[model samples]
Target: MTLNILSRQNTVLNKFIAQIRDREIQRDPMRFRRNMERIGEIAAYEISKTLRYTPRIVETPLGQAEVAQIDDSIVLATILRAGLPFHQGFLNYFDDAQNAFVSAYRKSTKDGKFKVKVEYISCGDLEGKTLLLVDPMLATGSSLVLAYEALCERGGTPAHTHVASVIASEQGIDYVTNHMPHQTTTIWAAAVDEELTSRCYIVPGIGDAGDLAYGEKI
Candidate 1:
């Protein structure tokens, strides 16, 4: 699996990232969601660089032009709620791409541990398609792996999977790297932090993205 961390570079994306991380700025739910959307747009643009393309001819008003156009079939799959806005970013760009949604939550165990369970999934056949699994936060990575497996179980395996997240923990990244398909998966993140809390939250990470984007769930 390949890991691509965007914060390693200097770009305007850093501004949106920093805004989402700021407690004051993040308090504005609208802005928070928009920032997530913005990040998603940027990520989609970067991911496009790796997709396969074919040359095509287009007729212009005065002449014909040759252009390289994307040939890959893209499916933008996102985790419920939190991944919605971020997923929209990708959609805003890949307007014609297919979409999938899966809902997974952590079921806490008595030993301060948890297991992820995927409850709902809506997707088309993923066979030979490029799946962009968008989730705003990757803390434990279990939910992500579980979600991917769930999609494959119902929709068949995708040709390649792009795991997209806004913020990822070191351990979470490691866990995902070990669990996902070695050669067919790639992880992309806007920023990667080092600490993971006992509660499975990324340290210095933007608090519950779902809650920040939507309202807190009971």
Candidate 2:
């Protein structure tokens, strides 16, 4: 089944594209990761603007004024290893929100094809909460689904879920639309690329996200 894909377009998102595409820019792991984080920061701000708020009075140096405050409790969940930096961006804005982390790996068999496996998960209660699931790359989306399922099993189903990604492939978007629980899920991607390589990497994607953010693993 096809679903609505929300493309986050803005000057900051364009900047993310420039950095992710430049060969030299990607060489510096630190900067590359920070760029991803910055993208998250910008997206977070945009998303927050649309959230529900209530009037609250605060005492200032001069006077007290009523202001609307975000009413929904937030839970930031990141698919680990690669998602750390991206997650950091969300955390920067959601400093007071509860945090959850999940580790997933793509397991391959003899045929060279693979499946996602959820290895580690840590989360708090999520019932009636708003959750933001951050993952750097949305390639095949199998891992994203697995991570979501793992979190739900551990932390109860959230009232709403926002899947955030730096780059997404069409196939990956399709996969998530088909596999994820659609009633409460909405996808927000910085950019959408048209390619999915034979090995499941988004073409022109900033290579291995974990490698770019962290380093090559043995």
Per lDDT, the best of the predicted structures is 1
Taking the tens digit of each residue's C-alpha lDDT, what string does model 1 give over 22-138? 999999999999999999999999999999999999999999999999999999999998999999999999999999999888888999988888999999999999999999999
RMSD of 2: 1.9
Winning candidate number (TM-score):
1
lDDT of 2 by residue, 124-152 (tens): 99998999998979998989988988999
lDDT of 2: 0.85
lDDT of 1: 0.95
